[model samples]
Target: MNPINKVSQARVMSPILSGLIYAFVIMFAGTLFTSLILLLTSANESNLPAFSYINHIISLLVGGWVAGKKSGTKGWYYGGMLGCIYTLIIFMIAFLSFDAGLNGRSFLLLCVSLLSAGIGGIFGVNSRK
Candidate 1:
């Protein structure tokens, strides 16, 4: 095959890249949705954290679906990876932007988000076409 064909074939086989892109898309969409919701509700920064969890959940579901759609039968792994990457990026952003006080609740939320994303990914992967 020509090198261009080989590159195209490689791209087709790259679930990781697809998953990462899905993650970014979902996260961006989630952030936009959450911002709009917050603006509509006039939610202050203090209450934003509580509402943000809902956004995370939404993002996870969407991300899982995207990953599953991209990966076919291997969607579970791809989705999970996407979730992990998304969480990492979000956490870093939070750490840099706000004073997310290290507390029990914060820790719990982190754990829950990770697990929820993983489960969502599995479901997405196994879901019917």
Candidate 2:
């Protein structure tokens, strides 16, 4: 293949990588936004722990759908991975940031996050193609 062709192919691949990064950023921002909202409103901090995972799921689904529309299978896969990564990061942050007195709930949240990502990936991949 010509050098130009190789460069073009790389350009094509760049969007997928970009989408993955964007997805993670979106999820992270969404988490922060949700946390801020909950904090500002003084809305029962009791549920704050659960809200983090919920926000992550919503963000992942939206991001995955957008990525699918923009890219394709690669977008779906990367988007889902991004979601998983975002969730893991947020989980760590939450664990360290708060003393919510969680009892085994963190593990459950992780499982829920994984399931949500899987569902978002499937929906994105199948719906786009």
TM-scores for every candidate against the unseen true structure: 0.63, 0.57
* lDDT score at residue 26, model 2, on the 0-100 scale: 70
How many clashing pairs in candidate 1? 0
Q: Output the lDDT of residue 72, model 2.
A: 57
Candidate 1 accuracy as lDDT: 0.66
lDDT of 1 by residue, 39-69 (tens): 8886777877666677677667666665666
- Tell me the tens digit of each residue's lDDT in model 2 across 1-129: 645544334345443345456557776788788778887897888887667666666766666555555555654465556556655676677678874544577667556655665566666667865
Candidate 2: regions farther than 4 A off: 1-8, 11-20, 39-42, 66-71, 74-80, 91-103
Highest TM-score: give the candidate number: 1
Clash-forming residue pairs, model 2: none
Candidate 1 ranges beyond 4 A from true positions: 1-8, 42-46, 99-106
Candidate 1, residue 39: CA error in Å? 3.4
